[model samples]
Target chain A: MTRSVPVRVHRDLARAITAIENGYASFGDTLATLPARENGKASFVVGVTGPPGAGKSTLVDRLIEKFRAGGETVAVIAVDPSSPFTHGAVLGDRVRMQRHSGDTGVFIRSMASRESGGGLAPTTHDATALAAHAGFDVILVETVGVGQVELEIVAVADVVAVVTVPALGDSVQTIKAGLTEIADLFVVNMADRPGASRTALDLKHMVRESGRDVAVLQTIASEGTGIDDVMVALTAARASESSNAGRAVRFEVVRNIRDAAVRRALAVLDAPRGRSVLERLRAGELTRLEAREELLVYALAEVINAD
Target chain B: MPIKVLVAKPGLDGHDRGAKIVARALRDAGMEVVYTGLHQTPEMIVTAAVQEDVDVIGVSILSGAHMTVFPRIMKLLEERGVDDICVIGGGVIQENDVPKLKVLGVREIFDADATTQNLIDGIERVVAEFGRARKRTGAATPAS
Candidate 1:
C-alpha cells in the first residue's frame, strides 16, 4: 500500500498538477507514490460532457455547490479547445464557477485540450487522480464542448452525465450512437425552454430501446431546478458498484503501454540505423514494407537492450 | 509548454471589450489564456491564479480601481505565498497611477495606447524572467 500524504495546500496541489501537465521527469514517480483509497471504493469522478452552450458549466457549478453543502470538497477540471493553428486556447469555463473561488472547499482548474481528439486534455486523468489523492471527496471533470464520438469521459469518470439542450433543430441529434453508449445519465438542460419535454421523451425512448438503465433528467440549470434529481441519480449510479472504475484503470494501463511503445518506435526511427533504412527506401533500394520491417526490428532491439 | 495566462476583469466594470480583445490576442500568440469574466474581486482573482498555476495574471480594470485592485491582488498573492506568478495590469488609468501600481508589485501596466503585440511581448518577457527565477530557486517544484 502506498503511504497516503494528502496534499492539503492549494499551491502545492497546483504545482504538482502543473508538473504532471508538463510531463516532468519525476511526475511518474510522484503518481506512483500517491495513496489509493483505503476503502477500496473508487473515487467519485463525475464527468459532465455536452455540446457547446448546453449549460454544462452552470450545471457543474450547481453540482459543486451541492457537494460543498454536504461537506465534501470538490475539484473541477474544465477543458477548452486549443486553436489548431495557434495551439492556444481561451479557457472560459471558469466564468460560471467563479462564485466558488473564495471557498476553500472548491478548487477549479481550466485546461486546454492540446492535441487530444477525445474532448479532454492529455493530462486530465493524472490531474483527476492527484485531486483524489489530495482528499477531495468529489472530482468533477468537465470536457470541452463535444460532438458525437468524444466519449473519452468513460475512461475517467465513475458516472458520466451527458448534458444537452432542447430544440437543437432535430431530436436525432440527441440520440447520436457514440454518445448514447457512454452515458450513465442524460441531462436536458434549459428544460424551461420549448420542446424540453419532447427532447426528454425522445431520449427516454432511445434509452428504453437501448435497454440500458440510463436515467434521462431535465433541468433548468440556471434556476437550479431538477438538479436534485441529477444529484440523486449520480449518487445512485456511484453506489451501484459498477465496473467503471476497473474499466477505467484497465483502459489507462493499455493506453499508457501503447503510448510508450509508440514513443520508443519513433525514437528508433529517428536513430542513425533507422535513418539509413529510410534513405535506402527513398533511393528505391528498399520497398516501403522492407523499410517498415527494418524499423520494427530496430525498435525491438532497442526495447530488448533496455531490458 | 505553452504559457498560461489569466485575463481577469476586476471590479464593477461591465465593459469587457478590451479584456476580450487582449484575451484573443494572447491566444493568437500561442498562449493559453484563462478568462475570468466580469466583476472579479481580488480574492477571487488570487484564488483563481493559485488554482490555475498560471505563469502570469493580466488584470483589466476600467473602473479606475487600479489603486485598490492592484494592491489587494498583490497582497493576496503574498498572503498565499505565491511569488512566482507575475501580476500585470491594463486598461484605462491616469498616467500618474501607473508608477504607484508598479510600486505595489504590478510588474507592467498598459494604457490605452499600448497595442496587443506590445502586451504580448511584455508578458512573454515577464514570463521568461519568472521562469528563470523559479528554475534558479526551484520555487515551482512540489515538496516531497
Candidate 2:
C-alpha cells in the first residue's frame, strides 16, 4: 500500500522487477534494455555482509534511517540463502527493516539466492539495476552471511561493508571467512556489549596486517549508535576509490550473457537431437564429459547465432 | 518463483516456537517465508508484509489475544488497502472463535494440532485463490 514513489514515476521499474523475479522469458533481454553505466546517474551499491547474528540486519536498519534522513532515496536487496534442495528461502531481512515500510523514499526487496552461480540470487544484479532505474540514490546489498564461500557480493557491490560482533571467536579467524580482502569498511556491531572494543581493535589489527587501509568502526546498531560514522566512512570510500566500480558493471554484463547462454542450452537440451545425446549419455554410449562438450558446442553456436 | 509468505508473531508472544516451525515448513514447501522475530505490533507486521509484497501472511498467536490481535491486523491491512494478501491464522484458538476470525477476513484458521502439511496445503490453496482472484480483477500487482 505504501508504494515507493519512484517506482510509481518510473512506471516500468516495478513491472521490470516482477518480470525478473517471475523469470519472464525475456528477462535476459530486459537486462540489456536497462540503463547500465554511463547511461544514467550511477547508483552507489554498498554490500553488507558478515557472520549470522552479527546484527547486519540491524545495522542496515540504522543505515536506512540515516540515509533517508540525509535526503537520499535508498533501496535494499536482502539476499537470503535459498534451500539447496527446495530452492526456497526464508527472507527475513524485511522483518528487521520494518521502520522503512511506509517511507516512500525507501524500497526494500527480499531475494532468494536462486539459480545464480554466485551467492546472490540470479536476478539480484537485475534487481539492483531496476532500483537504479527507479532513481534510488543508494543501494544496499545484504548477503546471507555465509563465510568465505559467499563472496559473490564482492563482484556486485562498489563498497563492501563487512560487519562482525564481539565474542565471535578470534577476530583474525573471523576475517578468514574471505572478508579479509573484500571489505572496504568493517563494522563491529553490538558495540554496547562487552568485548566490543577488543573486537574492534582486533579487526583494526587484522585489516592492517592484510594491507587494506579499510576503516574499522564500532556501532551499537540495535540502538542506532555510530550510524553516522558508518555513513561517513561509506561515503568517503565511495568517493576515494573505484575498488569494484567497473567490475560490477562488467560482471553484470557477463552474468547476463552467461545466463542467456544457460537458458539457451537448456532449451537445446530439451530438443530431440539433444535428447538423443542425453540418451547416449544415459546408456553409456558417450561419456558424460563427451556429451557435455557436444552440448556446449551446439549451445554456443546457437547462442552466437541468436546474438 | 514460489509465493512469498510473511509469518509474523505480533504482540508480546515470546513463545515463537510454533511460528518458527511454521516458517520453516513454509520454506521447505518452496514458499519464501519471512519470519519477523519475536515481538511485533500489527503495524509492524502489515508494514513488513506490504514491503515484502508477500502473497500470504501466516500469523501465529498463542497469547489468547486472537480476538483483538486478528481484528487489528485485518483492519490495518484493510486501511492499507492490501486486501490481496491472504491472512491465515494458526495457534490456540477456541473452535467457537473460528467463525469470528473468519468474519474478520482471515482466510482460514489452523489449530495447534494442525500438521505441517495441512498448514502448507491451506496456505497454498488460499494464495492460489488470491492470485486467481487478483488476476481476474487485473490486480496482479498492488496499486502504486
Winning candidate number (TM-score): 1
What would the per-residue lDDT of candidate 2 be over residues A3-77, giving only the tens digit for each residue?
Answer: 245324333354456566776535555554444433356888889998888888889999988788777788898
Top-lDDT candidate index: 1
Model 1 chain A: worst 10 consecutive residues (lDDT sum): A1-10
Q: Residues A171-230, candidate 1, lDDT per residue (tens digit)? A: 576566787778889999999999999989988998998788999999999999999999
Candidate 2 chain B worst ten-residue window by lDDT:
B135-144
Candidate 1 lDDT score relative to the true structure: 0.85
Q: Please give the lDDT score at residue A295 for candidate 2.
A: 93
Candidate 1 residue lDDT tens string, B17-135: 88899999999999999998998999999989998989999998888888888999999889888877899888888999988887887888888799999999999998877653455
Which candidate number would show the highest DockQ if scored against the true structure? Answer: 1
Candidate 1 is graded, for docking, as: medium
- C-alpha lDDT score of every prediction, in listed order: 0.85, 0.78
RMSD of 1: 4.1
